[model samples]
Target: MTTILVTGGTGTLGRHVVERLRQDGGNEVRVLSRSSRPYAVDLRKGGAELDAAVAGVDTIVHCASSPGGGDEQAARNLVAAARRAGVRHLVYISIVGVDRVPLGYYQAKLAVERQIEESGLGWTVLRATQFHDLLVRLFQAMAKLPVMLVPAGVSDQPVDASEVAARLAELALAAPAGRVEDLGGPEVRPLDDLARSYLRATARRRPLIRVPLAGKAYRGFRSGGHLAPEHRVGKGTFDDDLAARFS
Candidate 1:
């Protein structure tokens, strides 16, 4: 059993990956958590603490993200830490169109990828589609009002997080495959339809109103529309994701 280190094992996707590694496959997995007895160390501090924990690990599943922390600093620290430990493979979970789209979260992921590539280490960056829960959460926040206001004229193919995590684990097991194909939902649907579906699922009687936004992020989403409608290899659909919203 190859021993691997998974950052952010306590997070939504990180926890799933850890379970899959232990349950689905016969692999030794260690999570870099902040808690005692389990968490090896913190990567935010250049991974000195994690170095001892990951001394002999074969791979590093870098799921630990700086959601509120700036991406540039976090990515630099992680890459440096991995290099210091001589980790063989680094599997990073990122969103689709991160390079093309100029968003805070996506840009952070892009910076992380660049750091990994520049580190001269084995790496595989899996860019996933938007999680179905994200849209659900968005509607949850917006559906309260009589009008479910959403950005208009945008196409999205939200993929299941489980599928993405499975793929990330598989990629972690394999050799480095730089910049893999974009993973997305089976069908592409408008954002408004997705919002409506969420409302119906939750038995909410809210009408959706499309609102146009003027900005770089909106322009990027409208022009290319961070969607993988052309070559989709995902299995879950919008309804399927809605069925298994959260566990």
Candidate 2:
């Protein structure tokens, strides 16, 4: 039986991956998280805890990330520890536009992707679009205001995190394919439209006002840098995600 270690196993995407892995009932799956839970080893210290978490693991599905900052250091520490532990495969989850988008969080993700590539270990990087739940949360936060301000000309193809998790599980079970095809949602919609949909679903009436953003990040998004139209492999749509959550 293959042994798999999933970092950030308690997180949104990582939990789904962990669930799918456990469904097989043939592999030994462990979670490396900051919190102490069942089958979990803490990696916050990043020394012996990290080393012990990776030791004897055949594959490491790296889903742990800090979007605000410090993700690069986390990735470096994990890669170093995995190397020392002789990990056979490493699968990383990244955003779709990390390479093209100029956002700080995207830059951090891209940096980690580069580190994984140069780590000299067998690896696969899956770049996925923004998650539907994130968009929903964003709209929820914006609904508090009189006018929901959205970035003008920005579009999004929000994929379901569960779909991404399933793909990650499959990749973890297979041989490493470096930088596989991007994964996007079923359809691309304007960010304003998405906000409107969210408001409608929740029965919250809010006027969505488009505001032009003058930054490299907004330009990238407006130019569809975060979209993978050709790689619309995900089946779930934003509406479907909303229904599942609310219904």
Model 2 residue 8 lDDT?
94
Residue 240's lDDT in candidate 1: 73
Please name the candidate that would achieve the greatest TM-score relative to the true structure: 2
Residue-wise lDDT of candidate 2 within 23-71, one digit each (tens)? 9788999997888464455343478778887889999999988766778
Off by over 4 Å in 1: none
> Which clashing pairs does model 1 show?
none
Residue 244 in candidate 1, Cα distance off native in Å: 3.2
lDDT of 1 at 126: 85
RMSD of each: 2.0, 1.3
> TM-scores of all models?
0.92, 0.96
lDDT of each: 0.80, 0.89
Best by lDDT: 2
